[model samples]
Target chain A: MKVGILGPRGTYSEIAARTEFGEEIEPVTYPLITDVAEAVEDGEVSVGVVPVESLREGSVGETLDALAWLDVKVKSEIVVEVDHKLLGTKDSKLNDIKQVLSHPQALAQCRKFLRKNLPDAELISVTSTAKAAKQVSKLRKKYMAAIGSSGLADLYDLKVLQENVQSGQENETRFLCLSKEDSEPTGDDKTSVVFYTEEDRPGILYEILQEFATRNINLTKIESRPSKKALGDYLFFIDFEGHHEEEPIKEALEEINEKVATLKNVGSYPKRF
Target chain B: MKVGILGPRGTYSEIAARTEFGEEIEPVTYPLITDVAEAVEDGEVSVGVVPVESLREGSVGETLDALAWLDVKVKSEIVVEVDHKLLGTKDSKLNDIKQVLSHPQALAQCRKFLRKNLPDAELISVTSTAKAAKQVSKLRKKYMAAIGSSGLADLYDLKVLQENVQSGQENETRFLCLSKEDSEPTGDDKTSVVFYTEEDRPGILYEILQEFATRNINLTKIESRPSKKALGDYLFFIDFEGHHEEEPIKEALEEINEKVATLKNVGSYPKRF
Candidate 1:
């Protein structure tokens, strides 16, 4: 199978893509998630991968927004572990490094480490962990190191002076696999939908949410993004704990439609393990 | 007091900063949000002005996260009514313009206008609205126009091809007046807090949320961000309807703290009109 992931190479999506399918799958990298989704929609790629949360940044709003717009659906999910390691030149000593380069998320994950360990080092956030690794590798500058994947260290030919140096021991990123073709539900599934109210009115959200409460349909997550149509109006992206075909959820959503002017079911996919 | 705002020469923030306070306030411009928050935290600047949401990009998580880390509290608010206008060179007629150049947010807000009216024109997003206007001005690039403020058109010496082109009649941005010293809450008040619970232990969220529900406290918003501490663990950023000093809110928080490991009361300020 041919899979597409977002990257310039060595992004967490690349890692997730490989992990999901192993070496048997030929992986293609796209600059943007929208392109990856478009490739699936246009049948250029069988599946696409996107991180649930951003590795370079924090949240991937643009990807989620694109998902809402696309006709494609999520088919699988994977959790990829992330550890920001301090990569340096082969002969470089860890304690003497004066500058630390990393993506914003990596810098954040390793904040506590920077505070107590290399408080004096200047922190510089870049576009990607791999880019930071590449910069340090290319420059071969003394007193410079980067917080990136150990895999990237190998890719750029750097040494991991410290292992799993992130402040948080258990840092992991959740990735979603997308496809244009629908597959049979694996029974255990998750449904994602986007809903927007008719106008900016009070108690409207309460009434809509009441349907889920009444049916005891637990919502996994809910995020509000600007509708761009009007001021104060928001589009809520909600994830519920069951497939769209499930009775309780189907019934609850049908009830919800009466209250919301816009209701679009993005997808229903089996829970990936 | 020194206030830092985004600017070039005649940008809105530079004008707004001067108009808000007299020449007594020294205003500086910072390229990134994190720098502004750091300036506030380090006491290099007395206050930092930041747009609550990016017009092209939507809400910025890194900015909010940086503000949270800086521990700087918003002292007041500034609401700027964004009047997005389509500006182009004198030689370029509106119909002849093949590309619509604007900041991402403006392009997003004017989706309907682009689709319904300028269907022939391809939309191109730029770094900033001022930059877009400047591009048209400096380059005199034919068949290209920018969606920016009317003032920007004047500054760039570009003709206004279209006026008030944003989808929302009230295309506005609320700028926070942040300070290192937490000011006394105004009588008409609001409080914002960030908290995290033991990850996905069913009913743990319910326990904290029930504290508000049982107390009849209204929650304005509840957003979950990765705590970055571990996989599956999340930090909940909540904005409630009542002030922390109020009886019900105070009691509800007291009960919430018992169940959660960490709860930080970020700030209490006047509710912006």
Candidate 2:
């Protein structure tokens, strides 16, 4: 399989791509999540893997907004455990590091370790941890290190100066595989959709929720984003535990359509535990 | 009035501090939103002005999270129009610019202009636009420029090479003046609160919204953030047009408290239009 992913090659998105597809999958790299989705839509790749949510970061808005704007569907989901490592050239020692570089999120995750160990090191933010690792490899700077995955160490022939240096030990990120084709019903699935209410009334949201409540459908996620036209205007992104083609789900969607200004189904895929 | 703000003297936050308080007020600067909130909580400042939301970027999660964690309350709100300018050293020219520096958000807002004008110029991200201007002034690089408010030009003794470079003409940021004392109820007031549902059931959210629907309160904003413990766990932040002490609003709160697992009243203050 050919998978489009946010990458320089050894980032978490690459890890997610490898997890969802086999390790032998061909990887096409994109600079941003929107571009990754675009590659999938334009048939440059069979599928795209992008992080949808993080335990501490809430929602990855860029990915969500891209999904809402593009005519793509979710093919599968995978949750990857985040373990940020301190990578350095094989000849370098931890005490020799005078600078650190990584993506902002990865840098943030390992803030405590960085502050305590390399208090005087110049911290730089790059586009991705993989890119940082690549730069470190090219420079072979004994006084520089990059925070990335252990897989990056193997990919770039670097060494893990420290393992799992992130402050939050329980961090995990959820990734969604995007494609033009929707997943078939697997009996256990989740439906994702983005919708706008017809009016900005107090009970308008309540009325829409009633449709699902009456049918005993369980919602897994609900988030609101500004429509970008005004301050208070919003669009909701919801994920529920049922395929859209299911009878009760279809009826509820019809009822919801009557009360909403617009609705777009993001597609149903088998739930990943 | 004394206001704490995020600053290096010429930031938009400093402008907000001057706008909400008189120009004569003393402005204290902090490095982070949490520190500003801490200054207010620790009685170091009477009030603090922090950007809470922007038309493009949803909520400033740091400020929202700080408000939730601290004992501070909202005193007033102000909205500032974001007009980014291309700033340069005294002897610099636009044609000579080979690099640009600004906060990532400001850089993003002016992507179209930069692509057209300085396509080959290296874009560098700094902690704040004010800091960018500071760096440009110190370096005096004929080929370097910064994107920031026009006020920064005077503060850093730089020149405004170009005006209104942001892509969105309607860009504005909503700032909340946080204080230890809550504002007394004005006839037109907005109440803010954060609450968690007892369970993630289909109808549980509808039940909470019904409390406000029956009370005839108009909701201005509603956003959900993950509780950070797990994927589906969430907390809702709601802003509505009513004071907590008001009769119907009081009853709605009582009803909401009965149905939710936990509720936190952020505060009520006069709405800024």
Candidate 3:
């Protein structure tokens, strides 16, 4: 099987893809989340995996935008424990590190650790954690270090200066596998939908959400993203506790469709969170 | 008055601060949103201005986290038009650019322009757009360019290679002025609140929204962010049309307080959207 991921291997996206498809599948890397979704839509890969949300960073807006605008379905949800380690050259010690590099989100996640330990170190923001590791490896400077998964140390020939550098005890990221078709009804599934309301009035969302509330369809997530037309305009993305093909979920969606200007059923996949 | 902003100067946050306080206020620069909020809470600055959301990028997670966890209050909302320009040394031409440096969001916002014009250029992500411009200015390399506000060209002694390079024409960002106290009741105002529901079941959020619906309160925005405790756990941030001091809004808060595990009235400020 061929899988698409946010690239520069050894990142969390690759780990999520590997966890879902095993180690034998061929991995294709894309620069952005939209590119990965496009690859899935164009059938260049059997499936594409992208980070949807992280416990520390909330939801990934690009992935959400891709799910809203792209012609792809979510096939599965993968949760990966984000374990960031301080990696440096073999000759370097933690005290010798004067500069750190990682993706912005990763740097933010390790803020507390960095502030407490490397107080004066310059934090360099890169495109990805893998790229940070690659840069550090190529430079081989004793004063430089990178924060990423332990898998990166082996991939880039770096040493683990410190383990578990992320802020909270539980740092987990949720990834979505995209493909042409969603998964079959597994009895236990979650459905995701996006909708936009043309009218800006009181209780429009309240009334729309009532469809699921009346049917006792539990919602897992609800987020309002700017529609890009204006500041107050929003596109609501919702995830609920049943598959789209389920009877109650179908009835609720039908009711919601009538109330909203536009509705897109993103997909249904087995619940992972 | 001293006002805190995310800076190296010439950032949108600085512009938002200047827009709200006029150009005479002393601008204090912080490396992170949390630090700006801390400056406000510690009374180091009379107020702090931070970007809360962008039309294209959705909400700023760090800003949301600061509002939810800090003691500072939203004094005002400032909206700034994001006008991205391709800035380079005066000696350089557009085709000479081989690397484009910018904050991740700015880079993402101008993705179309970069992909079309500098297709093969290495896109470098930095901590902030001002930093990108500063780096480009310091290096003075013909192959280096930065995408940021046009004000940056003047601040960093660079020339605008192209104006309005952002993808959309209507790109705007919402910023919040944080102080010790929220604004007094303006006839037309907005209230922001954050709440957490301990129960993970159907209708909890719907029931909470019904409080505002029945009260005929219009919500300007509603977003769910991970509570940082777990993946499915969330803390809801709601912005509605009224001051917290109003009778109807007060009643709704009382009702919501009884329903949720924790409820925090973030602030009420004059509506800007």
Candidate 4:
């Protein structure tokens, strides 16, 4: 099977894909989350994996946007523990590092570590952690290092100088496996839905949430994103316990459908978290 | 007055600061949102302005984090129309641009423009749009361009190659003016609050929303972010239509406080949206 991921490889999205599909699957790379979703929608790939949220950084807006707008359903959810490591060329020492590079998010995650250890180092923001490691490997400079997964050090022929450099100890990223159809009913599953309310008023959202509350459905996550039409206007994405096929969930969604202008059922997937 | 902004300068944050204060106010630049908040908290600047949300991009994670963790209050909210321009060296033409550099969000906002016009041009992520313009101006290459506010062209000695390059036409970014104290009730103000519920039971959030609903309080925005403690754990940031000093809002908050583990009133600010 072919799996699509946000890439040039060695990203947490790839790790999530590998964790879901195993090592024997063929991996196809896309530059953006939208691209991965498009590939899944077009059937160019059997499945696409994209990071939906990180414990430290919160939800990935692009991934949320893709889920909200794209014609793709989430098949499963994958959770990966983020293990940020300081990688440098073999000859480089922690004290000799004058500059650090990584994706901006990764750099922010390790802000405390960098401030205390490499206080004067110039922080360069690149596209990805894997790309940062690649640049450091190509430079072969003793004064350059990258913050990423230890796997990057192996992929880029660098050494892991330090492990768990992120500020938070329990850093985790949640990824979604996207396909043409959602999974079948699982006893332990989660349903994701995106909806927009045409009217902006007091208790509009409260009324919508009442459906779930009345049904006793536990919401795993709820976020409001800009509708792109206006600043205050929003598209709400909600994830709740129970599959869509379940009677209570189906009833709640049916009731919610009456309160919102547009509603899209993103998918029902086995809950991993 | 000294106003801190997320900047090298000419960023939307700077524009927000100028909009909130005035053109004559002294502008202090900080490299990150947290730094801007820190400056305000430390009295390095009387007030700080940072982008909180964009119509196209949603809430800024860094700004949200700063609000949750930093000792700053939202004195006011400012909304600025996002006018992204394609900037380049004096001699650069649209067709001659081989690479585009910008903050990741800016680049994402202009995804459609780049895909249609500069199909093969490399997209480079920089620390900020202002930094991208600075880099492009320094290089003075016909093949280099940056996506940012048109004001950047004047600051960096570049020319505006194109106007309004972002994907959406109705793009607007909401900014917050941060200070030691939140604004006094303006009658038409909004209160922001961040809270965490220790219990993960169904209807916990719905019950919290009921406090507002029962009192007929309108919610302008509601979002859940990872608490960084663990997966599935969240800190909810809510914006409601009332001043914290209002009797109904105060009563609702008291009820919510009893329900949640912790609740912080981020501030009451004039609602610009």
Across B66-185, the per-residue lDDT of candidate 2 in tens digits comes to 666689998888989999999998888889999999986688778789989999998876768888999999999889999999999998999999998898743788899999877898
Which of the two, 2 or 3, has more TM-score? 3
A32-60 in candidate 2: lDDT tens per residue? 67779989899999899998877545567
Model 1 lDDT tens row, B1-273:
788876554455655565567657777877566667778888888888776554334445655576555678767656677778889998877787888877555676677787777888876655577777887898897788999888787788999888878876436565677786544645677677777766654344555666776676655555566566656666776666656788887888888888786888877677763
lDDT of model 4 at residue A143?
95
- Candidate 4 backbone collisions, by pair: none
Return the top candidate by lDDT: 3
Per-residue C-alpha lDDT of model 4 across residues B193-233, encoded as one tens digit per residue = 99988778899999999999889999888888667555446
Candidate 4: segments with Cα more than 4 A from true spot:
A230-233, B230-233
Docking quality tier of model 3? medium
Pick the winner on DockQ between candidates 2 and 3: 3
> All candidates' TM-scores?
0.72, 0.85, 0.95, 0.95
For candidate 4, give the docking quality class from DockQ: medium
* Candidate 2 residue spans exceeding 4 A from truth: A7-9, A25-29, A44-46, A87-146, A152-159, A230-232, B1-9, B22-32, B44-46, B89-98, B116-127, B131-143, B229-232
* lDDT tens digits by residue: candidate 3, B155-246: 99999999999887448889999999999997999999999888788899999999999999999888886686654466999999999999
| lDDT for each residue of candidate 1 in A173-255, tens digit (9 for 90 to 100) | 77888887444566788787888875654455556666776676656666665666765666777766678888888898899
What DockQ does predicted model 1 obtain?
A: 0.18
Model 3, position B197, has a per-residue lDDT of 84
Return the candidate ranking by TM-score, descending.
4, 3, 2, 1
The chain A TM-scores for the candidates, taken one by one, are: 0.91, 0.93, 0.95, 0.95
